[model samples]
Target: MEQQEVKTPEAVAMLDMLKAVPQQGKFMFGHHDDPVYGIGWDGDSARSDVKSVCGDYPAVMSFDLGRIEIYGDKNLDNVSTDRIRQEVVAQYERGGMVSFSWHADNPLTGKDSWDVSDSTVVKSILPGGANHDKFMGWLDKIADYLNSIQTADGTKVPVLFRPWHEHTGSWFWWGQNLCSTEDYKALWKMTYDRMQEKGATQLIYAYSPGTEPKDSTEYLERYPGDEIVDLIGVDAYQYDKDTFGQNLENALTIMTQVSKAHGKAMAVTETGYETIPDSVWWTGTLLPAIEKYPISYVLVWRNARERENHYYAPYPGQVSAADFVRFYEHPKTVFAEDMKQFEKKK
Candidate 1:
């Protein structure tokens, strides 16, 4: 493929960046508007909707890294890594500012049972530390992969690398189920240090703890540090419309509170609300909620459709990008102080 020279910008030092403001902004959380909105209509296909919804976003979500596996004896090599990396970068260049999220029970390196959320993998990595080496190694590999990319000005892609997101909840292997606060903190630090060692400075690491904390103070405790993160965000979903409404509100309040507290931009990294025959993401839920907030970006789960995938939006009868454009340009909705509005609202 083609390679470009990359020049790193003097981005506000992440910590100092957090200090610029009181750590709060408008429209911080997100939701899917018109399940068919930006995705248009195509049924439940995942890849097809990528192009359409890509236009609606200021940043694209890298679900592949978050959900897909590529390390260990999984036949990972330059060709293997390069293959997916090519596709990812192509998607990145196509979509522009891309943010990624992912989780794997397997430490950051191996391709073993740890990749699954099952008990075996979960039990192996829990608490005061059990196979810490493997976990650290896995992180090294992940960082190597991130450092491999270059931007148009010859810089690595500045990714919002969010791993083990929503740790406040108990669903994934790394959730509260497997580790204590101290262990979790170590895991976060190890990953950060390894990535830095690899020269993967393009990262704007995000620590998205869960929103189900006993209160706001508890939520703040989940933050690893402003030192390792550039933004603050959250993820929540409701099985039905009713529950979704309540949870969406809670999510917004928490995301806004977290971002403002940390002086960071915010978005909804993941959300899915199913409603009977149509799991309408746009009109049914996201639209009503976001109307009252000024979110930075709303990244639907990158997947298209899968029984196991709660992170996708349906393509058929999909909402058009026009809806997002109107929202983006809404006179009262401010995106960010320095956002680049490249595409006009459709």
Candidate 2:
């Protein structure tokens, strides 16, 4: 299938790099970290640990913008917006790929991302609804932060801006049952349109569903379109040995097929075994499931210092630390040290 042409030069360059991932025989690894504020591994410390353990930092870094539109201070797991922005710019300067996911609060309920009290929240925020203007106001804050991210030389840092992720899951207010497919599509379109209008052109949209769909039809049911979405992915996690590897494998297989059909890059936007109870979960479970597909990247959850059992990646003393190190050393896994070979979008 012919790849969809990207409008922005930066996006085009990024797409090219992503498309080349499989050819390089490596997939970039990412981790979500509130590292800057010391909630996760300390600022620069996560990377330092990755380097010490695996001889390099992760090739990609992820952050959440869940609370920036609401509190402006407190956030998902108490991560500060100030620290997030700083960390984003720092990662960009270091030539690392950065991705952001929005666990946006439900506009109508004034509750968290998990709130499902208002099933029509997306409808309310669409065109001529009651909360449309208020939602746009929130988007304004998001666009402002996105536009303000830049490198030391004033280059706009490109980000894989993934919003409304895991829409197939029922845990979030924007989940499948909470909003109609049309409303979900409208939500994504409005986000892209608003951000572009606000000069946040460094953004590349990604569409991620929760689990593996039965086929492409199910996968693309709520997809905005190929033109608006640059990446296709899923958010699948492993909780036990029963469905761990099979679930991930099935999700990636679906993602690969769907991405090929639309000519978009595929990614494991979110996947990890929390606490990594299995000593060999890294190479044995995660790697085998992903290596079969041509994915651009795979991002583990995070290592929160506050929550002793909430982390996905291994620390120095964790049981899976040795296996994770082996996973990092694998020929198919790309870490921060390997990113120098890839072209960074300007």
Candidate 3:
């Protein structure tokens, strides 16, 4: 396959690892904010809900850059950038992969990411728009952060950078209903170019839309281009057991087809049932839904420390803990300890 051309050796190797994962008949399991916090603890680097439930940490550790665009000391979740940097490096050192998602604040409305009050937000951040320069500054902050992720020897750690995600939904300012197709494409390209110009080379870009694309056509409706995206992913959550399995299967089929045609990797960028109400959700629902697909990884959302009913992955004594152990022990599921081979490539 003709892979996307990345600038750095680390990024090239990381992309290769993503490409080779499914060929080996395995898909990595991931968790958002796994090392930073968990269901009952905060700021503990040694703690991970997935690890507590199973025996190893997730293969992919996802972080957010929501407040990074504004030069905030902490992310929107109040996790400090210093902590994120530390944990990101720690995860990489542990032979695990790191992925970042950005929920950038609305530049036009000066509100949160969910502020889709203005329809011209995407247009205003393009090259010639009024907020163009300001947006460029925001990208600079992002670039700086990305560039700062380094090992003890100062070697940059390769990371999967996912920005402007879930654009298929109408919740964020950059959503489909708020921006034209051309403008959205331009936004992705501009971010890519800026990262390159600023020397943030150890990045593999992922383009992920919200779930339920009818087919490959709809999945790629707002695709920036194969040149800018190293991975094709989708964010699908389980609202109910009845429809989630078939829905996920259908989405993965579309993702597989699109990824093969475009020579990009594919993943379930975000997924999980809130609170894991079902005891066998891991193996019975999620595992079965994705087992047949050639996906690189499946990342569930965070296990929030504050909200009682807002967690995704299981904790130590959660109802799904036993079943999660089964999922972890499954040969098809890959975790941090199982990533040594891929880490060798880096």
Candidate 4:
């Protein structure tokens, strides 16, 4: 074989080390100062919103149930699919992260038994049923859509597919009282295997188990392997930040330790001061640790305050937006301060 050149010893070493290791996860987006604010607009066409607002920033964007559904009434129309694919490839060229997730209200494949909460009025539903044939068919369709948008590196862009997330709670039909433990495991494993066979290896499956004591063991109980898990994370949302703080701290600490134990990196896959005013929490408590923790990313779960939601975008007070933006994006901020000093050391 011909000799290959090395740009830098560090670069060469990093590449060689990463070669055997499946690049598990990295900071998909930067710190708050380097914020990634992509919202769930009408559908895939909401690329306009991203392009208009934070286009310059390397943000992580995503599609919702409206854009990805296949059979249900929410299925992506032919026009949306064609348009979104074009937009997605453009995003790839622009070095933006493309992601899509689902929380189906009814994951039925025509079999009633497979539908766990058939009679109950669960707020969230899985997009798939546990029946082998119906599920495989659904997975094939889903994987095909994802494969259509490969990265510039020729691999499908790694997706932050967070289905069946927050299962410790009962709001979603897949949670506590909905399905048996075995069925849940079977559902998870089958989904993983089905997606892999279809060549959508670019997916970064995030098992975002709820931040309750019971779900802690259940989270790792079915972790397929490093091959399947891209990032280990938690979806914790409640009023008491003081109470949630200890839980959040312990969760991240334990997750980081456990992930490191398995040689995987950690992330606060979904988090934010949802109802709490951004002022008290964003700067007072959250910012102090912005540079302190080993967290890879902190995605502000933006449930835009449109439909009587207090968790609206632009954050709380008018001043809060400025403070929020400055804290995350401003110079001399923790994130920026840390980076500036760290780079000088390098």
Alpha-carbon local distance difference test for all models: 0.52, 0.81, 0.90, 0.49
Model 4 C-alpha lDDT versus the unseen true structure? 0.49
**Candidate 2 lowest-lDDT run of ten:** 34-43
- Return the top candidate by TM-score: 3
Residue pair clashes in candidate 4: 32-328, 33-328, 33-329, 104-125, 305-312
For candidate 4, what's the RMSD? 7.9
**Index of the highest-lDDT prediction:** 3
Residues 46-140 of candidate 1 have per-residue lDDT tens digits of: 23443344334323434335323344322221124444455445544543344556555355335432343443443354344466555556666
Which scores higher on lDDT, 1 or 3?
A: 3
> Sorted by TM-score, highest first, which candidate order results?
3, 2, 1, 4
TM-score of each: 0.69, 0.93, 0.97, 0.68
lDDT by residue (1-346, candidate 2, tens digit) is 6543334566566677778877787799988863442224555534544555566667788888887888877467676776777778877666678899998988898889999887888899999999999999999999888777776777677889999999887789889899999889998889988887787878888899988477778888999998799998889899787787787777877887887778889999998888889999988888888898999999988877676677777777778889988888788988877777886534
lDDT of model 4, residue 22: 19
List the candidates ranked by lDDT, beginning with the highest. Answer: 3, 2, 1, 4
Between candidates 1 and 4, the one scoring higher on lDDT is 1
Give the per-residue lDDT of model 3 (tens digit) for 1-346. Answer: 6544456887788888898889999999999999888887998758888888888999999999998777568889999998999988998888889999999999888899999888999999998999999999999998998888899999899999999999998999999899999999999999999998888889999999977578898888889898789998989998888888888888898988898889999999999999998999999899999999999999999988877889999998899999999999999989999998766432
Better of 2 and 4 by lDDT: 2
lDDT of 3: 0.90
